[model samples]
Target: MENKVATIYKNQLQEYTQKVGKRLPIYQSFNEDSENFPKHRAKVLVDGVEYISKMTHSTKKQTEQKVAKITCESIFHEESEVESFPFLYEDPTLRKSILNEFVIKKKMKPTYNMISQEKGQSPIFIFHFAFGGKTYIGEEAGNKKLAEHLAARTAIKLLLETNADTLSPIIMSKVNSDDYFPKCSGNLQGESSSRHKRNANTNNERRNKKRRFGN
Candidate 1:
């Protein structure tokens, strides 16, 4: 059974590579122990990025096929086909849920920097988060919360694209959890308020001087 699955995965991978004009994914395997049982772990690299399988399997061939299947599905399928996956959350709440997964379960801290701001306008924010030793920057957004979500969503997409199987069990569980919701942080709120107030005051002072000078 494992051999049949491996052969199918390999054929699918070949078809995908031909259509996309990319090289076949490279697979590497190693022995590992899981719950005191001997297991084989496989990692596949597509387009120079590594994607790991979710778990070690009884056979190296099975592990390799599982990893290849995941990569092929992600690369060859349409968005609707893959939307059911936890890592491709399109909604803000889901995105925040994944972010919390990184924070609470993965023990990673997320930082939002107000990269640009103008008076009487929504500030531009940049969100920074790290995964698997790689730092990812989210697209700049008009507010800190939105930026953070974008950052988290971006990170999640990249992880899924390259190595969704590598995610920790706790993190994966959080991604699939139904109860996860966006929670506001007091510190982030305070920082935003402070910056807005400062910008407002500066703008007001400029207006006052202009009025006084009859300009």
Candidate 2:
């Protein structure tokens, strides 16, 4: 029999899927040994991936809820692992720029979830965003906004590296500009300043060489 707790978990799972903009479908099948038997098998599909329950239950609702719980856990685990890149956290400005150019401009909502919070520990947050029907998950962070930025940065970096020509002109311009590079301050200020000067001198030398060669 399907208890109230299982029902609640099932409902919560459904709500979570809807909040994340993913479709979760629960499918039920009957035992073939006896057409009139009450035993039912349940399976669920999350993001097109299917998960089946370990065994059939007495009622369809029980079977469905069991399958739903298993599927929900799997979905959450996969989404949590989506944050594969750790370097995005170093540049929040560039991250925000990526989000503004790609996600915000595309008119898709960014979803966030606080995965865990323990006493004396930073909260773990996950960010989710979709583009062209494909959802991208961001690396987990201590704060919601940071997690969102990380996610946006990951998506933008992946797109820029793999599919730059497919990006919009505005985003492409931002990616190509040195203005979007990470700014240094405090302890790193001296090093960054020296590096900038070196780059400028190199550019001037290149320009002078070009002029001399008439090319």
Total clashes for model 2 = 0
Q: Report the C-alpha lDDT of model 2 over 47-156, residue by residue, as the tens digit.
A: 67788888877777778888876765665555422221222222455555544545435565544343544436556877766655666678778887677666766677
Candidate topping TM-score: 1
Which pairs of residues collide in model 2?
none
Which 10-residue window of candidate 1 scores lowest in summed lDDT?
79-88
Model 1, span 1-215: residue lDDT tens:
33443455566666656667888778899888764676988888787778888887888878888887687666655643223343335556556555555454455544544455554655577877654578778887887778777777777766665555544343446444655553434332444446778999999999999999998
lDDT of all predictions: 0.64, 0.59
Instruction: Give candidate 2 misplaced runs (Cα > 4 Å).
Output: 78-215
How many clashes in each candidate? Answer: 0, 0
Per-prediction TM-score, please?
0.38, 0.34
